[model samples]
Target: MSVNNVRNIYCVGWNYRLHAQELGNTVPESPIIFTKPTHALVEMTGQEIPFPADQGSLHYEAELVLVIGKAYRPGIRVDELVDRMALGLDMTLRDKQNEVKKQGRPWLSCKGFLRSALITKTLPFPGIDNLGKTEFVLQKNNQEVQRGNASLMVFAPQTLVDYIGSRYGLDAGDLIFTGTPVGVGPVNHGDHLALYWGEKQLGECTVQLG
Candidate 1:
């Protein structure tokens, strides 16, 4: 299925130990949840992404995205409910995010802007068992800037689904962006971004300052 099949887009923050520490955030005792509206999605069609003007430090966060294929049921396992997976870029306006945090505001303006969520074509779910071997990354200008392995996630996909399902009610078409690892960094005009699953390049696009 394509991005059109996707419903709610849920995201986890501070879910990686090193990522949390790098951001100077306390390691959360529980998963920190947030979301992006469907409007934020932009398929990696090799189009140039126009960065929001004046939103300082646009950052690239590579994450493993799960496509929920079944209706939510309390006892269901991730492997049973999800049929596809993909690599995504959770683009953030870092400076704006930090400014809003100090004022106790929502991250919506900093995260849910147009074209903030970049996604690629989905692949068959790499079942929980093979999670250890499943790896993804984001390469900026031919250099690997960020990478993630499901096995290294602090809150595994199952746990995220379990936690989010209990409170938010995940639907069959919903998408859960598990979380990003420690190497997130800034994006800029003229920069080329690519997402990879192992040696396979899933998708790509160029950045153009808006």
Candidate 2:
């Protein structure tokens, strides 16, 4: 599927236990939901992500992305909602995020920016039964930088889809970022980022600091 088809970009924060603890945050009882505009979407193949000129502290968050196939109403089953899967990068402005957190403000500027949502091509989703065995990895400069399994998620993908759907009905072209794992860090110019699902390499791209 093309990135241009995505209508909504929903993201969950601190869904991984180690990721929460790494940033000194307590595990949430419910998913922490945020959103990025559709324009933020960027394909991973041979793409260059320009660093946000306004923010000095930028970070990379590797995540499992779910593509909604059927329109979801309240109380929809997770198995029926997801059509495809992919690996993605939830690029963030850490300094801006922290500032907003201190003032109790929303994270629009911190989380939603141009080319902030980078994704690999969609793969066939084997259904919710395969979730437990699913794993994703992120490589930076040819070395493993971050990795996580579905088992480590505080809020599973099914739970998130159900919960989020209850509050906001999901449409067919919506993409949900299941959240990042522990090894998230800053990115610089000329850095290479590669993402994988299980043993299958998904996508690779380079960073272009502006």
Candidate 3:
């Protein structure tokens, strides 16, 4: 299947209250939405991600990813939509992001860069809402770094689905990066990161400093 033309990459920012506190932001009244160009998508298990050299720091965000299987418009009930996913990384340019945020400009510069986003295999399974339990963890160099469960989310997956749907029409091939939990930090050159769901390996990749 041609993975190009990724319709949209919907991202939730600071959905975890602790993550917000770390970044010095309060919990949002609604889901914070952002977009990454389709070109940014890369398979973490097979590709090398270029670390931003000019930026002061490149951060790793471990998130639960939802891959949409069908088209959806705004206002659709979260229970009615089906999402396939596991967990993936949402890499970011922290210095660049802070600069842009200070300028009150859109986060495009911080979020949209070639190979800036990564995903594991698109495992098709039950929709996210149907999953009774959701857990996520990230390890770097075999060291546990970040841990979070779906229960910590300020808004559930259903709420996220419905909120974004009301504003943008979600279609097949689109992916959603739910907000990350605390423990986000920088990744150094040659750092190996592994993502896991329970006992299964979701994916892994190495970082090359640019």
CA-lDDT, candidates in order: 0.89, 0.89, 0.80
Q: Kindly list the per-residue Cα lDDT of model 1 for residues 1-210, writing each as its tens digit.
A: 767777899999977789899999988888899999999998897888898868689998999999999888999998899989888999999999999999999999999999899999889997999976967888999999887888887888889999999999988889988888998888778999999999999999999987
- Better-scoring candidate (lDDT), 2 or 3: 2
Candidate 3 per-residue lDDT, tens place, 50-166, comes to: 767777788999988877767776656544555467577788989999999999999887788777778876665555544546567899999999988887888888888777876
Candidate 3 accuracy as lDDT: 0.80
Cα-based RMSD of the predictions, in order?
Answer: 0.9, 1.2, 1.9
Q: Rank the candidates by TM-score, best first.
A: 1, 2, 3
Better of 1 and 2 by TM-score: 1
Better of 1 and 3 by TM-score: 1
User: Residue-pair clashes per candidate, as listed?
Assistant: 0, 0, 3
Return the lDDT, model 2, position 98. Answer: 89
Q: Which run of 10 residues does model 2 get worst, by summed lDDT?
A: 46-55
